[model samples]
Target chain A: MTVQKVWSLFDRSQLYECYECSKCSGSCPVTLAGDFLGPRKILLKCLQHGSGRVIRDPLLWYCTTCQVCQDRCPQEINIPELLTGLRNKAAKIGNIPERVKFTVEKIAKTGRSVLGFKVERERKRYNLPPVVEISKEEISKILAETGFFKDLKIDH
Target chain B: MALRYAFFPGCVIPAKYPHFESATRAIAKVLDMELVDLPFSCCPPTSNMKLVHYDSWLALAARNLCVAEEQELDILTTCTGCVSTLKEANYIMRQKPNRRRKINRILEKAGRHYEGTIEVFHLLDVLYDHIGLEAIEEKCIYDLNMKVASHYGCHLFRPSYIMYPEFLSPSHSYVPTSIDEITEVLGGEPVKYMRRFLCCGYPLGANVDEDASYEILREKLYYIKAAHAELIAVACASCFEQFELGQVMIKKKYKETYKLPTLYISQLIGLAMGIDNETLGLKEHIHKIKKLLPRLQERTGRMRATL
Candidate 1:
């Protein structure tokens, strides 16, 4: 894969247009809830420092990607997209949260988020049809081909 | 075009809240809307999974869309999160050819291609936009004259660029009113409350900080109670869990009481249409609908008799 392909993940030029305005922070649910730094500060960190610093911060995981900051950003900067890119890089370094790792691993291996037994019980209990089964072989191939397994260090 | 939709019941709903799935299907039958289930995986919730692997998220979402496109039918999602992820994916892949080519290149491994022929809608949108409020009014058998609060979860509204076009009107961009209109159509008064657009704190509450997440829910419940809301009607499964179960968690943790019953918008709609409570799974709600259903059933029986 070319460096350009990796760069495309974070290639939002609108991010550079940010003038340190706190409109994003003002509207951020995380910042308002006092759980995480607002989008403005995170973006500022990305501007002054590289994503390396931003990616490692445990606070990055707090963002629900609610998109309020991105919706309210005056500079048209796509903050959520940028945050996702940072998380991607973080995942590559194995800095992901355990809960997220569990979900991603389950999807990668089984092509669904939760275990099948629970769904089976629910299906039988509700008298609904069986849950649709995804072809795990195909999903694994797609994930491997897209370098997603490599990114998450999932064994193929 | 007899109102048929390829139903995308996202992962969580079937596993965690099967009652929601039951109620949605029962209500769809009442409205003469056909819900055909498709073999689809998760919408790959953007809350966390997408944050880690954008390419995987796009490819998975596009693959789901391809299934709906293969059926040559638009998707009708039961969860707000699924609609948001799938709708944004449709918008991006359809509009950007370069990105589409990139995703398709990966999708070829799964033997799927996303031509973007399908559109995505939350059940709320299908009720308000596709079915129309007037038709819903005519079908309504019960007058739920109680004051209800609309919890239009975060995914249904923000990221305006991707979802704004579907808003009721160009001027209605800032405030989406489909759920509110559906409330009135069902004969319930939609109560306005502070921070109506706030996140249910379910994603973060469940994922990152349990305490902070509960605090967010507590704050919303306080405001809803102050607004004199009898119940909180939510369009998202995650939000429903946050309010219904989160209320219990709040009581356990802080000894605070918020007896607000949270219902899926579909559950409430089914109730007003005189669908039996058992079929609608009204009894499955964590905060019991035991007290509220009689009032609705009594009114519905009287209305049907009069009609």
Candidate 2:
């Protein structure tokens, strides 16, 4: 997606209204946690250097997408949504994280995000009913229909 | 009328933390809340699938909602992450016709369709709003006078517009007190503490950055400990896991022991309602509840003796 296309995904008014106020960064847990570039700086970078530059930054993955920054934004700028859109674009280009890839593959293979073998053992000890099963074929079909396998370049 | 819901036990509760599932089921039985089981998948985990592909996230979440919709039941989720993803997807599908059509096209391939016919709720919502605090209070056998620091995991009410419409008032989302009120009704003091509204950092720490995640956990723990809270109560399985496991990491890395026993809201309520620790899966927790368990037992024993 082009820089213009990226900005167009959001309400342009919300984007333009950003007065460089640092409240987003100030309220951001990821920013407060450590040496990561905060949301305010990220928005500024996207505006100046384009979404491509910001998407490639390792700091982009650090956002927990907790939505705190967006909630606290005076201009109501949806930082989490913007970050998600950027991440989607990054993922399409195969700039995704390994753990994220693993999670998606696991979900595609099994019907859940995490493996259920250990859960099966634990539930037996507790005498709980076995987990309800969903068709893995159906899950993969949905992913393939959504172009997930294509976008992430994961072989089904 | 007995309230019935399709229990949407998200991936984490069953796959990683079955104890949470056990406690929720036990509590549902006491409250007479019928939790119908369904073949459900991950809530697609907002931090993972949503970030990777918006359409896939919506499609997967929509599929789960479709499963519940076919049974003609609303979803009651134990994990806050599932609540957010499924609720947000429902909101988007309901409010936007074009988006719904686009997703339905994908769903058509799987022989499923989401008519947006159902609502999604966190277990806390059903407990506080539908079940009523007075009803819960009446069932309490042990009066827990312990100090509890309630963690209302972020996904429960953030992005206020889509979530809990009642929290649309600007200030309401800023200071959520449903869990606090529930704690009070259970005969426990919901202690005031700083950093109550912050995210638990599980999304970051679990997948992306462990160090940064620990930093966030340490800050939240510092405030809860300073408040002299005897135990931590969490509404989300991810946060419960983070608090329990984070403390172990903090002990090993920082050499500081906060030792606050983190309990799922259901487990905490179950204990006060005279449920046994073994049934609630208290033994599965990383932090030892040795001290708190004895105190609860003592209170119940005294109450029994008086009777």
Candidate 3:
């Protein structure tokens, strides 16, 4: 991947406190789940070559973002969020995962999340949280559901 | 007194998030208050900012504050994230003129200059401040009798700039203040459920395994369900969205667990105002608060008979 101008402009010092802390690696549920996520490797990449190359790593997609790292970080590096920052930068440069694209498409085609239910779960329980569907007519006006349903390919 | 203030229901509630809008409007009307829509755009600080482009996130939040400022009313929002984003941006702009100028410069190209004048508040702040407990009592038609838990999402109260004076702690002691005062006025019991003030896992919107996105709420709901509260109340939109959307996901993922009902402060107040579930946008929800329906019907029936 070509070097992006944004990489050079970012505040490098903002995320510089992790002293090879493996606590975040120890705590991350995603890391435990056999995903390629751990704070030690992440901190090494970020420090050695700058975040530019780290942003392009496909393995960065495996974060569950439980923030167990933030919970347990002795150095308080917010490792998961740093990874999220890298992923976000990558996304701007065209790096969304295929599964995410699928979910987005499903939401676009349907009004709700991909987990759109046939039975209203709100009705299943005695307690309901305040949620309502977006009306179709209203949705058409804003290209409203499109961004959420990035998986779908309607012209609008 | 003539009751009128600028109303700024963000992108979600008015269209897709109608339940919140309907209930809020109902409660606003019963208080004899008028909410003038601020016609602002999204604060756009979430998935789009911090993670994506921090500058655009701040700029989007700034654009929203500018629109609300033009109206010169304390911008009252249904969404806590919007309120926090706008308020934080307003504070940022006030404290750092140089950064504000750069953000304003981007806005100027788009024909907007953010002056950092408008104050942003979540719906709870307005209900507590403008319509005091006494006012709510006067307008309340239903004594709900619900034992409620409160969810204060991080963006609303965390940074202290946007939170009420008393609730500044993460393990919030003042969890029950907003819902308690309103519930007490409406003749309900206020109960402290476990983890009453934790994040609702809403911040994980932009990820895969979105069901697992609810990993945080399991601990939260376990504590809440343990308290045996009849219902939960919230002051934040993303939290409410998380609770309502994640209830079934939480139940299924966590293995046959039950959760109490959830309500935004507006919906609860709407019940107090004699607004029916249909008009309050309850039909759109798959999560059922059927427990409160009969109580609400009885109140409506009594009011109609008296008339």
Alpha carbon lDDT of residue B303, candidate 2?
Answer: 31
Off by over 4 Å in 3: A1-54, A57-88, A96-156, B1-3, B161-176, B250-259, B294-307
lDDT of 2 at B63: 96
Worst window of 10 by summed lDDT in candidate 1 chain B: B298-307
Off by over 4 Å in 1: A2-7, A10-12, A116-118, B166-173, B297-307
Winning candidate number (TM-score): 2
Q: How far is candidate 3 from the true structure (C-alpha RMSD, Å)?
A: 7.3
Question: What lDDT tens digits, residue by residue, belong to model 2 across residues B1-307?
Answer: 8899999988888877787788788878878789999999888988888888888888999999999999999999998899999999999999989878988988998899889889999999899989999888777888778899999989888878888776566543455788899989888899988888998899898678888898899999999999999999999988987898899998889999998999999989988887777778888777877787656533443232110
Candidate 3, residue B158: lDDT: 42
lDDT of 2 by residue, A48-129 (tens): 8878788777677887778888788877788887787888888877777888888878887787887755778888776678
lDDT tens string, model 3, A3-114? Answer: 2234333345645776665876775544543546566777788888877787787666656433446545655454544664676567666676665544333333333332
Q: Which of candidates 1 and 2 is the stronger one according to lDDT?
A: 2
The list of candidate 2 runs beyond 4 A from truth reads: A1-8, B171-174, B297-307
The TM-score obtained by chain A of candidate 3 when compared with the true chain A: 0.65
Ranking by TM-score: 2, 1, 3
